[model samples]
Target: MISALNRLVDLVEDHLVEEVDVDGLAKALGTTEYHLRRMFSSLAGMPLSEYVRRRRMTLAAADVVRGGDDLLGIAVRHGYGSAEAFGRAFRAVHGAGPGDVRRDGGPLLAQPRLRFRLTVEGSTPMRTRLVDRPAFRLVGHAARVPLVHRGVNPHIQRHIAGLPPEEHVRLKALGDAEPAGLLQVCDDVDPDAREGSELTYLHGVAVSGDTPTPGDLDAIEAPEGTWAVFRTDGPYPDALQSTWAATATEWFPSNPWRLRPGPSVVAVLDRADDFGTATCELWLPVEPA
Candidate 1:
């Protein structure tokens, strides 16, 4: 996996001004583009697309300072049709317009090339299990919310808080399946898993496919698949978030599995009344690579 990611970085460097066939690359490397993109974002601390844009603009800055090629020529070479489009990308990455930089030969922000490595520390051992389950249904209240990586998502907090206290009891009574409790589900996420991207957040519980549907709830149909369930316990979301990040960083790198497309569900087995701390189960869908 580390080698594949290194090859991906090499591919980006080799084609900064051209289109990268990420799907083909993933296929060749025995992984899915979805997993590849998510892992890249996790380990590199930025989306792969963002990395490409920065690298392209980084090289373009040199040309802008050199002042030989026309702006249109430079733009076209970088795959932008017009100077305006290229300028927008340049300014986004470097925080200065191409014209300004070209004129003054100043204010350049360079994105250094990234290298990813594994660090093994003997710390808290993760409690995890791999489960194979049949298709199921997740039903209850659902809302669209922006993704927040590091902290508790207030949007989700408010959404769950808005539900009547009895609704939680009602949902629990309706559940009769694996993942046997109320579930926090995030679905229809951007493949890149970019922070602030909108995703379908379902505050629901798992039910068997044959369970009768209620009239007043949203339903997400999950296809049968394998799942990697990681159990966590620590201070609020900080511990959960760290384990989530580590899955991409250490677990996936050391395992023979890759994430498949499905909603990521969190089942809060136990929690403090004030919501400051909890022991939770984070379930991610996966398949043998």
Candidate 2:
């Protein structure tokens, strides 16, 4: 996985002035674009597209400082059709427009080319299990929410809090399959998993395939697949969030499994009365790599 990411970075560098063929590169590397992008965003702490933009602007700054070609020529050379488009990208990265930088030879924010490396840190083993689940239904109240990488997402908190207490009980009672509890589900997520990207957040539970979903609830068809389930216990959200980050940094690199397209489900097995701590089972769809 580390080698594949490094190759992806190299591919980006080679094609900075053209569209990146992520799908083709992923296929050549025996991986999916979805998994590759997700892993890149997770481990690199930024989306692949964001990295590309930063890298492009970093180089463009040089041309802006060294005067010879007009802004349009420099923009065209860097793949932007017009100076306006290039200026937007340039200002986004360097916090100064191309014209301003050219006039002053001033501030520049450089995003160095990325290189991925694997570090040995398996001292604490993750508690995990593999489950082959048949087609099932996730039924519940769902809303579009922005993705949050760390800490408790207040949007999700507000969603659940808005539900009547009895709704929670009702959802729990309706859960008749594995991941047997009120589940926190994220579906239709962006491949890059970019922070603040909108995703379908379903506060729901798992039900058998044959079960009929209540008309009042939203239903997501979960296709049959193998799942990698990780167990975590500690402070509310913090511990669960840490385990999620480690999955990309440690587990996936070490395991033979890779992520597949599906909603990630979190089932809370236990929790404190004040909701300060929890024992959670995070279920992620996967396939043999």
Candidate 3:
């Protein structure tokens, strides 16, 4: 996995002036584009697209400073059709437009080339299990929420808090399958997993496919697949969030499984009365790599 990610970085560098054929590169590397992009985003802390833009602008800055080519020519070479488009990308990355930088030869933010490496750090073992589930249904109140990488997501908190206490009991009672509790379901997520991207957040329960979904709830069909379940316990969401990060940085790289498209489910097995701590089971869909 580390080698594959390095190869992806190399591919990006070799095609900074052109469109990256991520799908083809992923196929050649024996992985899917979705898994590749997701892993890259998780480990690199930025989306693949964002990295490409920064790298492109990093090089484009040099040309602007050198004054060897007009802004339009440099923009065209960097895959932008017009100067305006290139200016937007440049300003986004460098915090200064091309024209301003060319005139003053001033501030420039350079994005260093990325290289992925693996380190040996397995002191604490992760408690995990693999489950093969048949088709199931996730039914509950659903909302579109922006993705937040770290800390508590107030939007999700507000969503859940808005519900009456009985609704939580009702959702738990509705669950009749594995991941057997009120589940935090994040579906239709962007493969890049970019921050601020909207995703379908379902505060619901899992039920067998044959089960009838209540008309009042939204339903998401979960196709038959295998899940990599990690059990976590500690401070509220911190432990759960760390386990999620570890799955990308440690588990996937070491295991033979790759992530597949599906909703990520979080089942809170136990928690403190004040909700300050929890024991959670995080289920992520995967397939043999």
**Candidate closest to the true structure, highest TM-score:** 2
TM-score rank, highest first?
Answer: 2, 3, 1
Clashing pairs in 2: none
Better of 1 and 3 by lDDT: 3
Off by over 4 Å in 1: none
Cα lDDT of model 3 by residue, 1-289, tens digit: 9999999999999999888999999999999999999999999999999999999999999999999899999999889999999999999998899999999996899999999999997689999999999999999999999999888988998899899999989988888998898999999999999999999999999999998998999998899999999999999789999999999999999999999999999999999999899999999999999
Question: Where is model 3 more than 4 Å wrong at Cα?
Answer: none
Residue 40, candidate 2: how far off, in angstroms?
Answer: 0.5
Cand. 2 Cα-lDDT? 0.94
Candidate 1 per-residue lDDT over residues 199-270, each given as its tens digit: 999998999999998999999988899999999998989989999998888788888999999999999889
**lDDT of every predicted structure (CA atoms):** 0.91, 0.94, 0.94
Q: Model 3: how far is 120 from its true place, Å?
A: 1.0
Candidate 2 structure quality by residue, lDDT tens digits, 38-97 = 999999999999999999998999999998999999999999999999999999898999
> For every candidate structure, what is the RMSD over all alpha carbons to the true structure, in angstroms?
1.2, 0.8, 0.9
TM-score against native, each model: 0.97, 0.99, 0.98
